[model samples]
Target: MGREFSHIARRCERAVVTAYRELRDGGRGDLQAFGACTTLYRIHHPEASMTEARRLVAEWIDHHVVRGASSPTDGCDCA
Candidate 1:
């Protein structure tokens, strides 16, 4: 499981990082933020399928959510 996530993390690093930063700065709810990220990704990668964009967004969200949960005082209102 960890190895799988590591592989995914490497594959989607750019999208995940950009999406996380954008969503965090925007301070929007998960659904709205994820949707916005997906749209932005699609715009940047027009050839990319919606499913791929959505999957990247979902993985990014899950990773950050878990990270935030682990660090309650990271100054990110993940709570």
Candidate 2:
């Protein structure tokens, strides 16, 4: 988990990705976990619209979990 999330500079991004991965591994379906992650993001950033939360969450999952890339992601400024 540390190795996977260490590259993320923002707390929100790291948190969303970690929650998504854990949810997926803990027998939750893909969409279910995704929804949970989106909700998690919105919880942290109420100013974000549902669409924004969904996009950021999806990007985080793809970058950290699916692609395993550490490239900086585009999203919230919270750290």
Candidate 3:
């Protein structure tokens, strides 16, 4: 999975994906990793609502991890 994240264009997306994969690989459960990722997003985007944070995190995880997709992702204006 080393090269899986190299192509991400957004800082926020890259951070979230790297952190989520690391957390999961380190024995964290799905919910735990998801919560940590949500918090990570909030740290970069404090103005984001909890709803928005969770939505984006889940979308990113599903897109990059679960779906193994390399396509562009949508989120905050952090690109």
Q: lDDT tens string, model 1, 38-62? A: 8876776677789977875665566
TM-score of each prediction: 0.51, 0.90, 0.93
- List candidate 2 stretches off by more than 4 Å: 1-3
lDDT of 2 by residue, 1-79 (tens): 3345677898889889889888888999999999999999999999999999998999888888888888898778787
Q: Order of all candidates by TM-score, from best down to worst? A: 3, 2, 1
Find the 10 residues in a row with the least total lDDT in model 1: 70-79
Model number with the top TM-score: 3
Residues 1-79 of candidate 3 have per-residue lDDT tens digits of: 3347778888888999999999999999999999999999999899999999999999999999998888888767877
* lDDT assessment of candidate 2: 0.87
Stronger candidate by lDDT (1 vs 2): 2
Error of 1 at 39 (Å): 0.8
The most accurate candidate by lDDT is 3
How far residue 15's Cα lies from its native spot in candidate 1, in Å, is: 5.6
Q: In candidate 1, which residue pairs clash?
A: none
TM-score of 3: 0.93
